[model samples]
Target chain A: MAYTKRIDGRKFNETRKMEAKVNIIKNADGSALFRFGDTIAIAAVYGPKPLHPQHLRNPEKGLLRCNYDMISFSVSERKRPGPTRRSQEISKVSEWALTPIVELEKYPNTVIDVHIIVLQANASTRCAGINAAALALANAGIPMKQLVSSVSVGKIDKKVVVDLIKEEEDYREGEGSTDIPLAFLSKSGEISLLQLDGKIRPKELDEAIKIGREASKEVYEIQKRALKAVGEEK
Target chain B: MIAEKKIIKQKVDEEREGKKKKREIAIPGEKIVSGKEYLPGDGTVREKDDIVARRFGLADISGRLVKVIPLSGIYMPRVGNIVIGRVEDVTFNGWILDLKSPYSSFLSVSECPRYIKGDLTEYYDIGDVLACKVVSVKHKSIDLTIKDRGLGKLDKGLIIHINSNKVPRVIGREGSMIKMIKDETGCEITVGQNGVVWISGSKVEDELKAKEAVLFVANKSYIEGLTDKVKKFFEGKRGGKK
Candidate 1:
C-alpha cells in the first residue's frame, strides 16, 4: 500500500517541534542547546586560539575542528562512550557544514573547536547537533558570514517528508526508508551539507531537497532568535 | 521566491527598527541597517548596500557610523594597546610574556626602560606580572615595550579578570568609572585592554572593594544609568562596613 498518511499524524512537510537556547555552558567561549522533538543536542565552542601539534597549524588560515558524539545512554541501545567510527565521520562532516560560514582567513594559525553532544536520540541527531553547533559559534562571537541549519528530509516508504522522527524512520513497508540529512546556509540559502542513506531516485531526491531547504529556514529562525534573545534584555 | 524573500526581509527590518529606540542586538549576518548612508564599523561588515553584523553584539549606531560592541569573544591583540601579561620565560635576549592570547609576546631588553647589565631575569623575572604596551603584532611574534609611562612590573595586590569587550565600561567615559573606583577604595587600578585588571590599595579591604566595583561595572556594562547604579552600590557597601 502507498504511504498515504504520516504514521505520526503530521503533515508531510511538517518538522517536529524545536527549541533553541544560547549561552548554556558558562565557562565555554560559547554554547547552545537545540532540541528537535525527542532528539536533543548541546554544543560548545572554544577558541580561535592556538592549535596544538605543529603540523595542524595553517599559516594561511584557521581551522574548524568538530567533535560529534552521542552519550552512552542517549539511545535505547547502548552507545560506546568514546569516539566511534560513526561519530568520527559525523564530526568531520559537521566541520565541513560549519566551515563555509566562518571567516577563517582572519585568524591564521588558530583553531576553533566545536563540540556537539547528543543527549537524546529519536532520529536526526546530526541535524540537531549541526543546528546547535551553528548557534554556539554565533554565541562565541566568531565572525561568520551566516548561520547553518540542518534537517533530514527524504522518502519514508516512497513519500518525501521533512524531519523524520524515530517512528517514521522505522517504516518497513513499500520502498522502505531513505534518509537524507541536509544543511543550508541562512544568508545564501546554499547547500553546505547533504548526505543520504538508503536508496533514492534522482527525481525523488529533487523533491527531498526542495522540502529540506524550506524546513531548514525554520531552524534558522529559531537559532537567530536564541542568539539575539540575551542581548534583547537590554 | 528571491523577490519574496526580499519583501520579508524588508518587513523584518521595519519591525526591528520600530521597537529599537536604544540598544539593538545584532546577530551574525543580520543587517544592522540597509543602505549606504551608514558606514560599517568594528564588529560589522559591509554587504551590498547593507551594513551587516559579523559578530554577536550590541548595535551601536552613532552619526554616520554603525558598529557592534561584542558581548563575548577571546581577546584579539592590536598594536598600541596596553595589556597585562605574566612573564612566562626569561629568555636570553628578552622575556616571553603570556598575554592570555593565543600568541606569546616578547619584551626585549631594548624595550625595557633601563639597560640590562646582567641577565634578563635581573630586569623582569619569570612569574612576575607587568602592565605593558603592544609595540607590534607581526605574523610570527608579538612585541611589547615597558618603557612607556605607567607601564611596568606590577607589585603585590590583586589581579582580576573580566571580558576584554567590557574593558571600555570598566574605564568608563574619560576614565570616570575607574577613577571613582580608585577614589572610593584608594586603590591604584590599571584597566588592561586585554581584560586583565591590576588593583593595589593600602588595605586589603579597600582592594577587595575596588575589585568588586570593577566586576560590578563589567557585569552591568550594557545597562543604562550604570554609573549612578555603581555609585549607589558603593554607598551601600560603605554603609554595611559602618
Candidate 2:
C-alpha cells in the first residue's frame, strides 16, 4: 500500500484535539460544551422530573429522551432549523447509548431529557454530541454507571484512522471506505453504541473497534477533568 | 438452646462489624452486597442475588439493610418535610406552588386557615412565596399545609434556590452549620428541605452576608473542612466591615 498523507497529518491511531467544559448553562440542570477538533457540540440536561402527559409515565423506571440538532449554519451548506431524518436517527442512537449508564429506575415516573446542538460539523458530530450529553448528564448530578465517551474511526486512504475530520470523511465516502462510530462506558469497559457505514472485513472491524475504544479512554479522561472542574470550586 | 442463642448473637455482631467496614463510594449498577445478606435500601436495588447501587452515592450498610446516600440529584418530595414554594397559579380548589421539584405542590385553601375564606387568591396570590409542610404526596401531585406555626406567607426576605440535594449540607450535622451562619451573620435563615432558602436581616449587609455563606456552602459542598472554611469566610467579612 502507498503512503497517503492525512489532511491534518494525524497518525492512523492519533485522535483529534478534544476540549470539554461542564456547567456552561446556568438555567439547565446540567450542561456541557465539547469540541473535537473543529466540530463542536453543546448539550443540556433537564429533569428526573415528573413526566408530562399521563400516558407517557412509566411506573417502574424513568424515561430518558435525547434530541440532537444541528444549527443551519453549522455545516458548509445551510441546513434546516428543525429536526431532519439524519438528526432524528442520531437522536435515537444517542439516547440508546446513554440509557445503559443512567439509573432510570431510581427516579421512577419521571423523565430525563438531554438536548444536544451541533454548533459546528467537521465529522463525527454524533460522537461529539454523545460526549457532550454524557458530560451534561453527569454535571446535572444524575446518577450513572460511568461517563460515556465516543469516537469515529474510519479507513482513509487505505489506512485506518481514529477521529476522522471532514475532508477525510468525504474522501473516504467517495472511495467506498468504511466508517465506524463507537461509544464506550468507561467504568465497565462495555460498548454501548456501534454504527458501521460501508463494508469492512471482520479483522478490520475488530481493529477499528479496538482503536475507537482506546480513543474513548482519552475522551473519558477529559470528561472526568471537566466534571472535576465543575464539582470543585477553584 | 443456650449455645444456639449465643451463636445467633455472635452472627449479628459480625454483621454489624461488616457494615461499618463496608461504607464506600458507589456508582450505578455496582454490586454492594448479596440480597440474602442485606435488604436493598435507598439508592440501591436488588437484582438476582446481588444488591446494586442505583446512583452515584455513598453505600451505607447497617446490619441487614444497605442504602446509598446520593451525592447529588433532584429533590424527591416527601410528607412532613418543610419546603419553601412560590405560588405559580390560582386554581379553584388550591394554588399551584413550585417547590423547585419536578412535581408542583398544591396548597389547598382549606389548608390555609379555618376561617376568612372568600377568595383563596386574596390570601395567597400568584408569585407569593411561602414556607409550608408537605402533608401528602401521591404520584405527581403533592399537598402542602401552611397552617403549622412558623409556616406560611413569607413577606420580606431574599429567596435563593440551591440544589435540594445539598439542603442537608446547608443545615449541616445536628443543625450546626445553619446555627453558625445565623449566629455569625445575625440573620434569620430558614432552609427548606426542597432547596429553597429564606434569609431576613434588619440590615441589608447582614442578609447579603448570610446569602453569600449559603451559596458558598452549596457551591463547595464537596470540599472537606467546609465548616471551618465557612467560619473563616464570615470572620473575614466582619473584619473587612469594621
lDDT tens digits by residue: candidate 1, A78-101: 987898999999999999999999
For each candidate, the DockQ is 0.59, 0.33
What is the C-alpha local distance difference test score of candidate 2? 0.84
For residues B1-242, could you state the per-residue lDDT of candidate 2 as single tens digits? 89876775676689776545734656455688874656888867788888987665567777668887765668888999999999999998889999878777898888976565677778889999999999998865799998999898888879998989888889999999999999998899989998999999999988999999999999888776789999999889878989
In terms of lDDT, the poorest run of 10 residues in model 2 chain A is A225-234
Model 1, range B87-184, lDDT digits (tens) per residue?
99987899998887877789988888886887777777989999999999899479999988999999998999999989999999999888888989
> TM-score winner among the candidates?
1
Q: List the lowest-lDDT window of 10 residues for candidate 2 chain B.
A: B19-28
Q: What share of the true interface contacts does candidate 2 keep?
A: 0.39
Model 1 chain A poorest ten-residue lDDT run: A225-234
DockQ computed for model 2 against the true two-chain complex using alpha carbons: 0.33
